[model samples]
Target: MREDLRYLLSTFTARDRFLLVMVVLAQFTSALLDLVGIAVVFPLMQALTGASLEGGILGRLYDVLGGGSRERFTIVLALIMILAFLAKAVLASIILWWSSGIVVRLQTTTSRRLLQHYLTEPYLRHRDRNVGEVISAVGQGAQMAHTSVLGGLLQVLSQAMSIGLIAVFLLVVAPLPTLAAIAYFAIVVFGLQRALAPANRKAGLEAQNAAWASSHALVDSLHGFRELTMHDAQGFFVDRFDVANVSQAQSARRANFLAMLPKSVLELTTMAAIALLVILSVATGSEAAALPTLSLFVAASIRILPSMVALTATLGTIKVGRAGLEVVVRALQEALTSGVDDQDPRTTAALPVTEAPIEVQQVGFRYPGAGRDVLRDVTLRIPNGSSLALAGPSGSGKTTLVNIILGLIPPTSGSVTYGDVPVRQSDQWWHDVVAYVPQDVYVADDTLAGNIAFGVPEDQRDDELVRRSADRALLGDLLAELPDGLETRVGERGSRLSGGQRQRVGIARALYRQPQVLVLDEATSALDNETEHRMTETIRSLHGEITTIIVAHRLSTVRHARQLAFLADGRVEAVGTFNEVVSASPRFARLVALGQLDLQEGPESA
Candidate 1:
């Protein structure tokens, strides 16, 4: 628990820590006011009952208030008590409001930080982890930290302080009863902790895992909804989701039940302690004289009992949430130590707006935990403002090589350089000069102009530039058909647009950046022959204006390239012009023959 608290505190900023201290002070002040309110009850009761107030702090207060008649003294005491109670209530409300704000801020800050960490991580790191688990950590884990960790700790602190102060006052008035009550409460709490610790931990871990699994099930089902519907396999995903949902519900039920148990047990114990105190007063034959002290103790008990119950319940919640807290903390720690410096280079230096040839020399790569290299001593050079096509089998390291060129991942051996500078040394600059269009482009549910202008902020989006890029990608005709033109809203993942239109939107987005080099990784693979040819023509139009690298299985897509490279078994088999490579390598010749036949047959026949 101490370790968990330390980690929780580390999550807070200095300003937040300061606010927390203020909250504690406010709570302590409220508790003191409450104690004063309870202490005054004894004097007020004595005065009303016609008992003498000639001793103790109450007596001193009575003298200060000019005690003369019982009626007058009672009235003054009553007013004092009323005012104190009102003041305490007001302060308590303020404390509640302030703490609520802190919890909200904590949730937002943690979520944002976790998201930033995830975004800044390298591509390989993201591919290695489960997306659902990451989503849960960013969503549910942040909420738990606010509700279970920070909120629980604050509740425990405030209640414990109030309980402690009230107990001390009770001890001053009636030490024996107060000590007995403390001992009983301590025993109940300790025993409950010992008995429920294991179950609480188990529930917490199960809840976290189940939640992640449910999220994974939902995301998978939604992403593959088309396939499931076509194959009538929706029941399989439904059953998987149901199992996870049931487990999560069970864990939540168990946790809530355990949290409520403390209140029930404490209530019973409180009743017994009050009864015992009455019995002790009677047995001592001081029952008649102990009325004032009994009244004070009762008033203190009213506040202290609830404080004890709340403290116990909050402790239980913390126990159940510890597992989630650990997971969130671990993710934050990993992100902090990921060793990726993601600061904007524009802060220090600006990249030159010029084209440069990309050169790869003896580059090799092996995926983490893989037995063999994916790329072995692979080397190539792309000239400035010249098109190069990379044609290879599915597992021949084409995408991997592109990723290295894009500076998304580092090579295991040797290096990739641009204009005599290593890519790693100018990663940010490299990104600025290169634009990539994958086979399937991601389109947000936003306006056509927004999707075309992708990363540019709304206020900064240039309509002229968007139109120019759209025209360059051959999207002018589609835009003309739309009712709202640039303002048309593209459905989620561009569902509103045809596959060809979506690919064109992606090309327009890449062109919007006006990059010095454009990379297309089988970007036209899913289109029909007409769309494929049109997209290829669009690429050909860029010719000498942009350095283009094409990774394609379709021979027609790369036929116009000045140079072509063929890869096999993680090594470059041949690198030359189309006819040169086809003549030099039988493998290249065979692939071209197959590609041409597929294109001639049309996609339906292929």
Candidate 2:
């Protein structure tokens, strides 16, 4: 728990810490004002009742205020009390403003840091985790930090301060009674905490787990809504989500009930204690002399009892939120130790413009915790300004090989290089020279020009470059069809565009970077015949100008490539021109015979 608290505090900046200190000071000041206000009540009451004020600070103040008649003294004391409370109100507002501001900043800052960390981590890390869980951790986890850690801490501190200062004032006014009251409240708080600790902790843990589960289920249901509706399986998701939501609500209810329980018990105890004090004062025959002091003690208790109750409530809330704090702390620690470089100087640097060949030398790759290599001894060369088509059946490691060549992942053995330089050492320069279009193109809900000029800053976006790239990607006709040309809005994930149009947007995005190497991982497989032909023509035009690597299951897409490589069982079966591969490898010939390559015409015709 101590370690978790330390980590939570570490997330705050120096400025935040300073603001926290100011809030604490403001709380203390408010407590002091409350004590002063309660103290004034005694003098005002004494003046109203015509009691002697012959000693103490009130007597001295009475003398200073002309030692006036009781009515005038009462008015003066009442005005002072009002002013003190008014000042306290202002201080209370300041405390609230600062504390709320801190909580908001923590939520936003932690969420941003988590997102940036996720983005900077290696690609494999992303693949190995559940996307729904990641989303939950970043989105809901941040809200938990705000409600559980920062807000809880501030509440506990301010309430505790108020209770402490008020108790001290009571002790000064009536030591014996104050001590007795303190001891009784202490025993009650301790006993209640002991009784409720296990239940609170259990409820908190349950709530945290249920929250994550519900969030994950909801995201999954939304992302797969089309599939669910088509298959009549929406009830499955709804049932799953219903169970999680009910559990979360139950746990929250249990925790909140426990947190509020202390207020009721404290209120009863306070009324009984006040009644007992009054009876004892009257029974001892000291009622006349003790009335002023008794009133003072009773007034202090009236203020202090509520503070004690609030303190207890805040403590209960903290216990209920402990599990959430632990989860957030663990996430932060993992991000810090994940071995991903958060700051890479090369991200903003200029890339080399000279073209170079990419070479793969006996590269083998086994996925983490996998039993066998996905790619073994895969050696290939993509010469500068030449197109290569990587052909393979499913699970034959074509995509893995392309990933290695693109430097997205390191090989388990051997090396991949660009000319004489290792790809990893080039850092962002490698990415700057290469653009990748995946099978599923991601289109943002943005303007057509914005999607095409994706990563470029809005102020730096060049309309001319967008037009040129769109033309090269064969999107000119699509743009003409749009009512707003480049300014047309693509719906979320490009729902506004056809599959072929989305693919063209992906192509235009890659071309806008003016990459030396363009990689298409089954980019044309989703398009219709005519659209695929157009896309293939676009690739053909770049054949001699930019190095192109195409991983294709459709044979027609790669039929015109300068070189072809066939892979099977994690090994390269053959590498040559298409005709040479077909003549040399029986497996390649079999695939062609079985029509697995989806040829428009016979192999001999190609």
Candidate 3:
């Protein structure tokens, strides 16, 4: 356990290392002030007993203040003591305030780093991880790190100073009792440390597992809630979630019960020690010769006990915090190591590409952990100023092909070329030149203008250009109808708008970028016939200006394209003009014969 903590703290960055040092130093200062406060009890006792402060730590402080004036120095000594007490209070408050700020900064940095890594990691990494695990690491990990850093450093300082001060006073008054207190505290802390290590490890695993399970249950059920309701399986999901939560609660309770054991023992041991000291002081008549010694002993015990208790509590918390931080450190290390192969591969600027178009050559891909390839031996070319429509049956790998082009997923074999350069290390390359509109459009809960210009730089955005794009997308009239025009808020996922309106907003977002390559993955399938026709008209108008790839289910949507490719069984069946493929391929001919091509047409027209 101690080794784990050493590794965790040592692994912190240089800035964090310096912060830790400052926290420990501040804690030491606060501890010194507390010890100084404890020293006051001895002088107050002497005043009550009519004894003189002639030979003690306080007496020395007084002599230094008085310059050897033994007589009539009490008044001056009293005033000086009061000033010293106030000074200690002020200094302690300052250190505590500083430590609090340090802790805030530490947690803030931790949260930002984790969130950045999460956003930038490759898509496959997220596929294997649970949303809950990532969320828990960022949320709960920050809180625990903040608390442990502050509590651990402060207590270590407080307890060590208090023990040292009390031990010195006890030795001066009586050696045997001092030795006994030191021995007792050492054993208690050691035993507490030993007993808590296993529990800490267990708690870390439990938190991770429970968070992951809960997240899976929540996301899966919500995403598939309609399906589950149709199949009457909602009760089953609830039962599973309940079981997971109950098991996690039980594990937490057990861990808590184990942590409390050390405190119970320390409390009982402290009470016994105090009783023994009182008995010895009375029986041996040590109070008569140096009755003030009893006050010093009592004062030291009073001050030291709370510090020791705080130390024990924080030690337990530190153990748990260290375990949690190990998880975070491992995640950060993985992020650093996993996605570093892209350096010096390729570069795509934010500005438009002046090179030739993209070409795919013999690209083969299979999902990780899957038994069969989704796309096999695929070869295709998209010219600089021509559009290609991908017409395929469901499960025919159209989405996988799109994902490859976007750099969201890497191919298992073969290479993709942009102009004459092989696509490599092109981070956000698609964003640089390609604007993608997926099947399910994402709508932000912000102004209509904000959703349309999602990726455009604020300073570069021209309102006139944005308005033209909206008109091209057939969404100009809708935005004008709203009270705030383009500034009106769209509800979550554009829930307030019709399906066709939402699809138009998505089209506007894509067109706003003025991308060189625009890929529409069934983006307009949700729209009505009129809206779909308008969208296709606008798309065809930019045929030479932008290279477009449309994944189409409705053949009517692709009749205007220069070329059409029919995909079936994860391979390209045929590629040619609409009538050419229908005449050559029986699958295409059957679809045409059945009038499925004109799905938007009424039955009477068919």
Candidate 4:
């Protein structure tokens, strides 16, 4: 428990820790109030019977009320008790509200921070992790951490303090019964907790794993909807989902049952203690003398039993949520400790500079856990405002090279630099300078204008830029067809749009950035020949204005580029103008022939 708390605290900011300390202190104050409320009960009951007004709190009150008019004394005493109870209730409610707000706010902030962290995490970390797991950590993990971990711990502290204060009161009133009851309750609560500790730990882990598995299964099934529909393999994926979901459900059910067990056991024990105390008082022929003691014990029992039940439930919740809490804590820790520098570069303004060439100096890269490098000693230079086309066979590392040049992935050896600054060092300013159109564009369920503007907020979106970029990407026909034009919702993943339309949207989004460097990886693959040609022209128009890097799927896309590189394996075999590469390498010639391009036609010189 100490270690778990330390782990969680380490992930929290100084402000969070300070707020948590304040919450604990508030809980302590509430416990003291509870003790005061309970303490006033015994004397109040004695006053009601008019039996002992000459001792302790009752004596003090009697003297204060003039010790004369019995009715006045009773009425004033009752009001004092009522005030004590009201004070305790009010403070309890306030503390509950405050603590709840703190927990919920922390959860909201932590989840948002985690989402941002995962979105901006090092690309290598992303490649090595599952997307669904990241989602789980941000969603379910945050909920459990706040409720089961934070709320549960709070419950235990408050209840434990309440019980301790009540015990102290009982000791002052009647020490023997207090000692006996504490001994029995402690043994019972401890035994129950110890018995279920291992089971709770196991169930917590199982539930966490099963939840992640179910989420991953659901994501896979939905992502492969087209394939499943065509092959009638939906049942297989559903079965996997069912297995994971059932495991999660069963683990939760077991944990809940275990959590509730102690409540029932404590209730039974409480009733027994009440009955035994009564019987012993009668048996000892001391019913009259022990009436005050008996009342104190009974009131304390009523309070302690509930506190014990709450303590048990909280302990159970903490045990059950510990595993998920660990995942959440780690993600929060990662966000705090990510070596992206102490300051967030994403918010920094770009440096004022003229066109600068992108230089790839002996860059090499390998995926984590891979035996060999995918790119090795690869070097390329894209002169400012010039276009470079990448071409090769399927496994020729064309996309990998483009990604490196785009600053999406760091090289294992050497470096990629934008002008004088390393791309790694350039950070968000580099992202601002470059625009990318991937083969598979991610389209959100948003309006056409929103999609074109991409990450920019609606109020901040420039309508002129959207229309210009859309027109440049040849989206005029699609816009004309839409009833609402730019305002029309695209539906989830752009389901309302065709593959070619989606690609065009991707192109428009990239163009909207008005980047200094534009990279297209198979960006024209989905377009029909006429559209592809028009799109090629659109790209061609940007030449000698912004540096263009193209990883072409179709050989024809590179025919008119300023320069072309034919990559084989992970190395460039030939790099020159299209005609020059064709004459220089037989493989390049064969590819051009395969695409049915005129072998003798030469493009405009770079």
Candidate 5:
């Protein structure tokens, strides 16, 4: 716990430290009012019994209240008590409201910073971490810290203040018994912490495990819902979820039981002490002494025991909070250590005016945990105003190469250049010029215009431009059919649209950027032959206007490219016009034999 505190303290920025101080001071002020309430209890009691204090603190309190009839005095005292209660209530309310808002804001800020870091950080960092876990940890960490750390600290302070007041009053009354009671309470709290520490740790781990398991189940279910429904496997998923829920419940129950044990023991010990005090007061010498002693013992015990109970509960919360703090601290550490000094050089103000030729020079890359390179010593030059096609079997590094070109992955060796400048170092230049249509089209749960303008700035999104891009990508007819036209909401992932329509929407999205270079990675795989043919014609029509790179599985699409390259394993096997590569490379000849290439052999081949 001490180590956790030290670590948490280290994460606080200067501004956070200031907020911490303000929260602490507010809590202390509230606690002081509670202590004052306890102090007033003794004077009220003495006044009720017709006992007058000649010169002590109670005497001063009596003089301050002023002489009056019993009814008038009661009224005055009630008003003062009411005012004090109101003041404390106001303070508590403000503290609680502000704390809750601050926690929410802080969590939002943390999550936003995390997202920015995720986008700007190196690709390898994402591969090393879990996205779902990072988000969950940030959310839960802020909630727990606010509730347990800040709230528990306030509770403990309130309890400590009450104990302090009781101790001071005890000095004027039964000192020995008061000391003994305090000692007993402290011992019980310490015992509770010792016993529950392991339980808190175990419970925290179980909670995190259950969260991950549930999230994994949800992701799997969504991805494979169709298959599951066809197989009638609802019971299987339900059973899996039940296992996680039950494990979480059992762990919580155990932790609660452990936390309660010491408080119960402390309460039993308190009752024994109260009983002994009562007996001693009743048996002792004079009635005056006996009455006051009993009153002091009862008042002090009542005040102090409640505080002890609160502290015991607070101790458990603080322990659990310590566990949550670890997750938050780990996430912050990761974000700070990402070393993204050269990640992206793009700025919104400086947009690329035209596309430049893209060149991959002796680049090589391998996935983490994989033994061999997915792309190796690969070199290619796609000049501006030309269309090129990459043809390959599955696992021939087609997607891997595209990822490198898009700046999604960095090469392990060599570099990619646009014109003469390194692509990574010229992010803004490349971003405005290059657009990608990925194999898996992502249609957001938003309007048609929104999905097309996913990366476009709001101030730049024009309705006319959106319509123009739609027409260019052949999605204008589809949009015209929608009830709201461009304003119509697309269902999640465009599940309402046919596969070809979704693909066209994706193409329109890329075209919306008005990019100088457009890369399509099997973008037409979802469309039928006629749709594919139309889309290919639309792409070919762009011709000298933009540089185009297409990864195609269909022979018909590959034949349209001015140049074609066949990739085998992790290297280029052949590159030339259709006949040049077909005659020179046997690998190309086999591809033709396997019907992987469309040859212009007959008059009907058109």
Candidate 6:
């Protein structure tokens, strides 16, 4: 627990730590003021009851003020008590504002850090983890951990101090009643802790799991909504989400009951204690003799009882939030432990990446925990200006090889180098040199120009460059049809655009980067046959200008490439021209017959 707390705090920035300190001081200040406020009532009560104020510090103050009437002195003490409460209220407001800063800072900062960690993870890590789990951890888990766990801790600290200071003040006023009240509340708190702590912790963990489940069900189902509707299985996802939500609600209900139980239990038990103290006081002495003590006790109870209930509730809430805290801590620890290949990804940016062949040297890769290599002894080279078509049957390590060459995944037993320098050494410049377009293009909710110039600020975008890139991707038709042309809003996730249009936008995005190495990972798969032909021509036009690597299931897409690497299973069976590959591998011959490679008008492969 200690180690986890330290790790959690380490994620907080120095500014957040300073804000936390201010909150602590505010709580302490509020508690101290409460003590003063409660303590002042005792003197005021004594003065109102006609008790002699001619001997103590009150008498000295009265004498210093020319022995004012008892009424004026009583009024002065009452005013001081009012001022203290007023000050506390104002300070409480300020503390709330400061507390919000810490929570927001912690949530936003930690969420961003986790996001960066996930984004920078090697590609295989993404493959191994569930998308919804990562989504929940980065968004929901982060918010809950900050709002509940850290906020609950603050509540506990603040209330505990209030109780302690008030208890001390009460002890001085009436020792026996104070002692009995303290003992009783302590017993109740201890009993409640034992009864509710395990349940609260369990409920918290249950809530976390339910959140994960519901998040997974919702996101996964929404993404596959079309398929679910076609299969008439929408209720399956609905039921799954309902079950998770029901569990989440049940856990929250249990926690609420536990928190509320203390308030009532403490209320009745405290009222009983106060009544007994009053009865004993009156029975054992005259009412006049007991008035001052009774009055003091009543005032103290008014302040202390609520703090005690709040302290108990706060403790229970902290237990509930502990589960989320554990989740957040584990995620952060994983991100830390699974270090990136490039310690500082930008450190080698200044080292120039010379235009030379991209070399794959004795490369062998096996996914983590896999038994065999996906690519074994794979040696290949693509000169500065050449196109290599990665062709294979499904699951032939074609995509993996593309990823390895693109530095998205590192080979387990080999290294890729650019112009004799290791790729890892020039990762930043490597990124600037390469641009990739996946099979399913991701379009953000932005204007057409913004989508083409993805991640570029609106003010910094070059209108002409956006237009040129879009034209290169054959988006002229799309641009002309749009009412607002380049400025038209693309709906969320490109909901307004067709799949092929989004793919074209992705192509245009890659083109906008003006990269030297272009990787199209089944990038044109969504296009119609005619569109694919045109795009293939566009790709062919870039021959000997931009070194292009393409992974394609369609033979027409790779018909005119300079080189072809045909893979079978996880091995590269042949690396040569189209006719040479067809002669070398029977699979290529079969593909040629199936795809009618010779029927297409194309240049002879290099």
Off by over 4 Å in 4: 55-57, 340-345
Worst 10 residues of 1 by lDDT: 597-606
Report the C-alpha lDDT of model 4 over 1-606, residue by residue, as the tens digit: 566558766656899889989989988988887787688678767776667677777788689778877677877766776776688789889988988988888888778778878777777677788977987898888888888888889889999999999898888888888899989888989999999899888888988889899999999999999999999999999999999999999999998988888999999988998999999999999987788678877877887788899899789889888887888877777777784333444585755455899888998889888898888888888899999999999988898888787777888998888887888623777888889999999899999899999988899999999999999999999999999999999999999999999999999999999899999999999999999989988888998888999988698788888888889888888889998899898988898888898866546642
- Writing each residue's lDDT as its tens digit, candidate 6 over 1-606 gives 456667898877687787788899889999898888888887777788888878986677667656678998888888889999899879878887879777878888788778777777767777788877887788777876887778878878888888889888778767877888788888989999999999988988898888888888888888897899999999999999899989989988998998888999888987888788778877887677778778877887888888888888878887887877787899898888876332544343553765577998988899888888889888889988899999999988998888888888888887888788777522688888888999989888889999999878889898999999999999999988999999999998898999999999999999998888899999999999999989998998897778899899998888688888999878889988777788899988898898766733445632
Which of candidates 2 and 6 reaches a greater TM-score?
A: 6
C-alpha RMSD by candidate, in order: 3.4, 2.7, 4.3, 2.0, 3.5, 2.3
Local distance difference test scores for all models: 0.84, 0.83, 0.72, 0.85, 0.72, 0.84
lDDT of 1 by residue, 495-579 (tens): 8898878888889999999988999998888778987888887887787899999999888888778788998889999988777
Q: Deviation in angstroms for 54 in model 5? A: 3.3
Candidate 3 structure quality by residue, lDDT tens digits, 1-606: 455455445545788788768767765666566656666566655655656557766567567666444444555545555665577668767766777776677667666667767766777776787777787777766656555644465656756765776577667667876787788878978888887877866775675567557766777777677699999999999988877777678766765765576777877888887777778778887756556666676667666776677677677766666646666666656656666332332344564344467787788898888999998878888888688888877998988888887777788987777676665423555566778898888887777887888855567667777787789899877976899888788887686777778878888888888888888998889988887888888888887899888897887787667777788877888887777777677887787677556433421232
- lDDT preference between candidates 5 and 6, better one: 6
User: Judged by lDDT, which candidate is best?
Assistant: 4
Off by over 4 Å in 1: 282-285, 340-348, 597-606
- The candidate, 4 or 5, that scores higher on lDDT is 4
User: Clashing residue pairs in candidate 1, if any?
Assistant: none
Checking candidate 4 for backbone clashes, the offending pairs are none
Clashing pairs in 5: none
For lDDT, candidate 1 versus 2, the one ahead is: 1
Q: Candidate 2 — which pairs collide?
A: none
Give a tens-digit lDDT track for model 5, residues 380-486.
89888888788888899988888788877788887887777676622656677788997789898888888888765567788787888888778867877899988
Q: Model 4: how far is 600 from its true place, Å? A: 3.4
114, model 4: CA deviation in Å?
A: 2.2
Query: Each model's TM-score, in the order given?
Result: 0.94, 0.93, 0.87, 0.96, 0.89, 0.95
Report clashes for each candidate as comma-separated counts.
Answer: 0, 0, 0, 0, 0, 0
